[model samples]
Target: MAKNSGRSRTGRGASTEPARKPLWRRIVRGVLVWGAALSLLGAIFLGTAVFFTMRELPDYTTLMKSQTGQMIVVRDRDGRELVSLGPSYGKWLSYADIPPIMAKALVSVEDRRFYDHPGIDALGLARAVYVSLTTDRRARATSTITQQLARNIFLNNSRSWTRKAREAVLALALERKFGKDQILELYLNKVYFGGGAYGVDAASRKFFGHPGTELSTAEAAIIAGLVKAPSNYSPTADVEAAIGRGRVVLGLMVRENVISQSEADEIDFSKVTVAKEKGQDSVRYFTDWALPQLDMLLPENKEPIEVWTTLDRRMQDAATKAIDGNAPKGTQGALVSLDRDGAVLAMVGGTDYVNSNYNRATSALRQPGSAWKLFVYLAALEAGYKPDDRVVDEPVTIDGWSPKNDGRNFAGEIDVRTAFAYSKNTIAAQLGNEVGFGTVAAMARRFGITTQINTKPAMVLGTSEVRLVDMTRAFAAVSAGGTSVEPYGILKVTTTSGELLYEHKSAQGQVLVPRYVAAGITDLLQTAVATGTGRAAQIGRPVAGKTGTTSSNKDGWFLGFSSGITTGVWMGRDDARPVGGLSGGHAPARAFAQYMRVAVARRPVEPFDTELKLPDWQLEPDDEQLQGEPGEYSYYDENGNLVHPDGVPGQDELPRYEDGSVGPGPGPGGVPPGVPIAPDYGPPGAAPPAANRELLDRATGRSVDDPGLRPGQGAVIPVPRVTPIPRATLRPPAGQQP
Candidate 1:
């Protein structure tokens, strides 16, 4: 009974011990089961991620063909590079050629374990997550250098989950495809380093004034630090901030054993010198002018292209020098030169394109003043008038408006050629009226004056405004024997692969003006240049042009042309105020002369074609007519005596034609007005017989050689005489004359 009680107590005591096992063993068993299950879940998640990432990955072939940016190279007509516009990326450096310091600085500051990682750093990521959890801070980026390169080369920078996943996938694929050196080389080249510089080489040159391979430790660190915040830490833009960031890089390099602490301490950020921004390139004006035309020229092209232009570098330099040397202070100027085919050889829009981009050469409508007289005289030539036709330069009023000459004085009975040479405003106005204002306007349009013109009589004095290019084109038409030409700059366009995109060809069209008329006008303009207002524009060669000064001297213009080139120059203040009395015959003409001397130095002097025929009336009036009254009605005999209706010497003559007269009557030779005078019809020194003259007049219904007639008998009508008449009396019945 005792033994049984002891056994029962022992069993109870053992059972009461609560099955005690080692505490560590129990905990180990539970941890093992849970850990295994979690590991399985992790494995599945990683496998699935790899699957999706690989599926979204771009083919390596596509990646190889992709470009980070497009490049546009503009070359001059001679195939010389004028300017390069785009994200400037210097020559690509191979991995081996990259400076060791550059790579060291990049790796130390960006990713210390760049070589050891696949695409993501496991230890770094864990630390980032742990800091976020414990310190209540958001997780920091743990992207490896490879990841950054992948994103920069192929992906958009977005913070969305999808973009991040794609970036990670692309990064892993990049790492798998490229070795560590290849990845680093691409990162160094593909990264943006601010200031329109892309890649290490360009950044080094831009910020340090040196090439990438020659960068020192400090320079390398300075550039490397910019990758984090390029604009905020640009060495040229924010030196202090950039130095601060660079110090951080130096300290990191020290920590990574890339440099000794002493070496970093001895570095002086203050002594670092960055390259100065270069002066604005002169070609920027041309590029700015050409940019808007790109869309129309290459609407379907999304890739970059090269444009070959017709800009003659030598001529451009000459024009620029001319403008700079001649433009008065506080005033702006523009110059445009075109070849005979109307290709823009040189175009200078302003004295300084950096200060202003307003391309006055192609834009900026200013009144052309007397330079516009070319069209007026051209209209006159088309209106059966000859260059030698006599015109009264006396002040004349039309519809209550009187236009005066530039000198405010008139020379009586000047020939058309002499009047034009002097830029006679009164004669131009008179001719404008005689030919009709509408006819003058139409003639100007035919000459390629695309601007709106006023029909008022003052338009003969260039009251209307026109662009320099359009005006230059007009003059070029005259230079080209009246053929119309559209000015062009771009000669051709080609892709980087040498594919032809566009080529400029001259447009075909009928001549805008008759060759004879152009030749006649050219002759008159040449006379002007030779002895008149444009005398300052003589270039030791045969050149023709017109000088124009607007009212009050607000705008000055000298538009001239050589046998092979036509150039137009304008000077004025932007505010439209007077240029302190700078006339077109002064600075504008001087600049034109200066440019033309250089432009035509190699070309031969070519005189204008002047073999055109002239009408009998336009021939030099008989020596006696030179002494006639300035009035339009006066006629003179061969002996310088005023002639009368009876062909007798007298001071006053009867009206040449009467009111409502249809034909002229016998006076001198008795030839009708419309009848063509035979080349040798009359004796040189003797008057025709009266009986023969009377017979000729009866046969032709009028006298062709008649200089005067009764009030109602001739084709030439006098100004109607205003005789005072009594007021009309009202009559009580119709048909009653009061």
Candidate 2:
């Protein structure tokens, strides 16, 4: 019993020594604790920096809203929408609302395996890394869909390694904060499509005129491929590339088992279904019309809004095609068709919407040339100049500013019909002076030519610059028979949910002129095609038009209309340089005629709503038919009155003497004395005198005086003497010479 107690005390004594740990374990524990604490602090710093950055960002909503302004939706008379103008963006829909096929196609084409990745695909990152290490190229971006969305909404199309890094970080954050579906939805809604489309939905409707859900398999594939590069796959811009991209999308679908391989392989690449884009800027023009209404609806920084218009796609297409075919080569053109009530039917800004977005028809202010004279003549008619009133076409000058006729010749006494038919500048100038430049300027403004008129006599000749919209609108007033209609681009603006925002109304007012007076002017203009300078504008239907050619051949314009449409065409270089020797009648009219031929092919024939009455004037005898009066009887002396047979008093009497002076006054062909004699210094009266002394001497090869002679002969020139100088003396007899 004593030994057992001793052993127990010994075991207790052995436990008194502490247990030893390995040096490596102690080092690991200390390192892990310190590393964890530092990581936490670094994360806190990063979070704080991110928070401050977010706080300093500009308000996106406010920034976008301040830009909403006057929007116009252009449409045809049939209420078919052509273009949307202003800050118009299409409706936004959630990714859940998007078709499954659309989503699959997009994912397959843009980023396959999107669902399997966390913001970024590890495989894609690895591939990018491998490429960067082995290849001589810059590193490829390894961004996810969320990253693209963030960049599109808040950044530029910058291509930098730093930007790529930011995108990756933002993408991870975005994915963690928002659901995958929400991220995709924002991405689809925030991209830009060609032709001013803002989102996939808007793009679908714009290219195909159908909703996103209604897209065909091929159409959907084409659109989905565009998200990667819109211009590269734009059907209008790069058709071949778009087809190639469409094929690539189809192949991806087959590869992903989204569609049967057989079906994908059997797909016809040759037959791509591209819906015809109606007018050039239909949606943009409509947006242009609707922005003002949107401003009034929610004037503050407005969210991207939707607007519906009454532009007809077919009419818009026709108008666009017509303008493209008619506008001069290398020259931009614009067309705006409107109803009598000032509602725009179709509008085309330029031939290629992708190349130029300047909207020349509404925005470019060019001189209207003779197109403005319609108003001047209208004013004259209102001032009581009848169609048959006599107006002299003699050369005239007004206030030191002379206006020449289109051609150099002047027609003696023409009636107003012929005068207006010829676009006689002298007659128009006289009318402007008679009716006052202020009156003509006021009349032009009333008819919608609202640009500044010089109020000089030249303004009557259309020297003032005006926009195509204004010039056509002024002619439209004549087309509508005097009730001026303001040219407008918008019909109505609305929200995505069909809430009415605003509507457009024509500008109201009248510059007093009776309907009959305006009709009379229209009648005169019709004759412009029938027989005048605008004859080339004659269409199959009864047409009325005016040809306008600016000085120096700088601008050529044709503004005309059938019973249905009034269109204006201006052909000139953008730099305002002169064109290749063209007149308004030849190039501009031919282009206008060619376009109208195609545009009006399907349109029904309609006549102007005015009575056709022939005036009591007959065609005057042509120059060839009018015999010139005998030259002897026609000319007069300096007084300008007709000369009598008794002749010009002692100045120009024939050498026949009534009392028979010196052999019948030297006969019929005689040269008499005091006939304003030319000097002859060849020995006084030598050989009936060589009047042109130097010329005769030169012709005969006779010895002539040479200045090089020894101080004896005058200077000898090879050519005839122009004028003789008085002989100089070294010492002048001053007073006597003076």
Candidate 3:
């Protein structure tokens, strides 16, 4: 009692329990305790989430099947791999087959604890965070090999915290479900090394030009370096940077004891070879354009399919070379080539596919300038206007907008053929008005052009945006003698096991124009190529095509067909900026020449069924010698048979020649030179029309469209005699004029 009293008067005895803290401190303690409890609950919740996520995670089999389903391998007509739609891979390499040095290099540079971690790499991650903060070593500081594999196999290549969390959780699941060796093998076989290459095999072949089985240690080191930044460290993109990264990998290998320091030092990285850069890989453009069609051809989520396409490597390579060699700086080009049946043989969408993958051939909708004239002229011909008919090319205005010729003076009373050859905008505008702009748009649709076409007068000058492929197909219709065709790419699709999925069946073409109409258009195209803006595209053969230049020279095009191969070329800046001095008759035409020069030699396209003939007095007046004695002459072919552009010639009232040969006069194939004639002849052995009735134009000697007609009456409208070709020719020029 005395001792207690001696203590401070505040207390008699010491309390057995600890002293009470102040209110603020107690509140802080309570908060800390609650925080700890919540953290524990969060941990339990995370574990449960991991349990469910693991359940949902794809197994090895599912991973492989999903990848297989996404992959679409394309083969050219000759069965060589052209391009791949999804992740491209070579033969799969097992962990044992993977160079032991390759594994060590990746593990050393990517995750030192790869062999020991449960895929999450808790300690390695901590060290990595510490090293990233404290050191200057620029290496792969996050994501273990297993994590990378998980992200690549199951998730999109997107960067986000959610993605990372999923990757971490999935990595643990991978370790829990799969053996370390199995995971390593998958990672080795499923990693992306850029340039459309996936897996060690594809990376090996793409980078070193060798099989993965034959990779050297230095080469392996280079591949390991790409895991951090595939595009940045691409061997093709930057060899020096790749080698420097490879050196880092080798140093890491030395630290990991995967290789002796002496061995690492002795490695000759200088001898490391990378694949030569193909100037421009344009083949991918075709594949990308055709990939969407693949989905329509195959079942959804189907196993890997082998696509046999109509792509011709020779033509494709030639197109690429031409575009790359001729396209001006900062400009791009697109080319589309088709057969008479409209099979797409070659398509070059841009100058450098790596720089831009937007397919201009099938997708870019640039103004065509005068190339749009194909439809306008066709519409006029269908409306009873002959190629030799007179068309005014003087200044014209429609809807308060006047269109002028490119030159100071206009060829005022030019023949339709002349106006077409020269691509006269005034004449085209006049013709568009005469036939109705709607009809011109209909004509384009008739020829398989599906792009939206403006019905305004400027549309005649190609002011309406159009695609290269669609225009190419439009020309293909004329080349096919009036039969319309749709451009096609994939010829066949099959599974790897030879299971046929889809096979192409060509449908009978729908005739969109009369054979005479086609010949008339052909005549115009041929003359343009020979003497007009398309002259630069001349292939020393009968080529029917035209040149188009847009306003401000923004887009230039040369689209034509010779010997059955129709090609369309477009050159311009992507932002619609002017390509200085570029014209359809210039770079685009030159490219056409370069491509066709090689294309014609590959196969024999039948000469157009109709031989090019001299213009009439109402035609080609230049051929004056064709005018024979002033008496009516009957028609005869080179074989001495009477025929017209798709009909049997009138034989009942034919006048006889002095030689008693009926129509053996001085003109070509026996027609009087002075007498006006029409070069309308059907292909040999062509079956007559369903009615089987035949008629001839008395005024022009052309096959009339009817079975009956009065004397002096004519098929279409009567026009003065002028020299003319079998096809329409003659036009006088200017924007998207040439």
| TM of each candidate vs. truth | 0.70, 0.60, 0.61
Error of 1 at 370 (Å): 1.3
Q: What is the lDDT of residue 155 in candidate 1?
A: 79
Query: Residue by residue across 1-738, what tens digits does model 1's lDDT show?
Result: 435555654455545456778999989998999999999997788667766766765664454335556656677999875765676666567788899999999999999998887888888989998998899799996688987887887678888998787777777767776678877887887788988777798798778877798888888999999998899999888888988999999999999999999999999877788887655645677667765676777757644467899898888889999999999999998998999887888888888988888888888999999998888888778655677666677777765679878878978767788998999998888777665555566667877877776666677898888999899988988888878877888888887556888888777645876677888888898989999999999988888899999988999999989867999999999889987879998999999999989888878888887556544333223422653422222334333334432343332332243354333334587755632222222334322221233353332223222222112222132212222111131111335332
Cα shift from native, residue 78, model 2 (Å):
6.8
Q: Which tens-of-lDDT digit does each residue in 1-738 have in candidate 3?
A: 335546666666677798888999999999999999999998898778778888887777676545533567789988987765666666678788998888888889888888888778888667777887788974345788998888888787787979888888888888888898888888888888888777888799888888898999999999999988999999999999999999999999888888899998899988987887544489989888887896687777556678999999988989989898877778999999998777888999998788888999989999889999998899877655677676666776666558877775687766888988988888888777665555676678778776665555566788777888888988999998889878899999987556788999999899888776788888889889888878999877778899999888899999999988999999999899887898889999999999998888866655555433432212223322463322223345433445443332465634455566554333456555422244433444322221121221222223222222112222131212222222222232322111
In what order do the candidates fall by lDDT, top score first? 3, 1, 2
Q: What lDDT score belongs to each candidate, Candidate 1 first?
A: 0.76, 0.65, 0.77
Worst 10 residues of 1 by lDDT: 723-732
What is every candidate's alpha-carbon RMSD to the true fold? Answer: 13.1, 19.2, 13.6
Clashes of 1: 8
Count of steric clashes across candidates, in order: 8, 38, 44
RMSD of 3: 13.6
The best candidate by TM-score is 1
Candidate 1's C-alpha runs over 4 A off are 1-43, 64-71, 89-112, 123-142, 154-166, 177-189, 200-278, 352-355, 497-499, 507-510, 601-738
| Local accuracy of candidate 2 as per-residue lDDT tens digits, 54-145 | 45544533322222243344444455554565533455666777788877887787778678886768798788888989999776754677
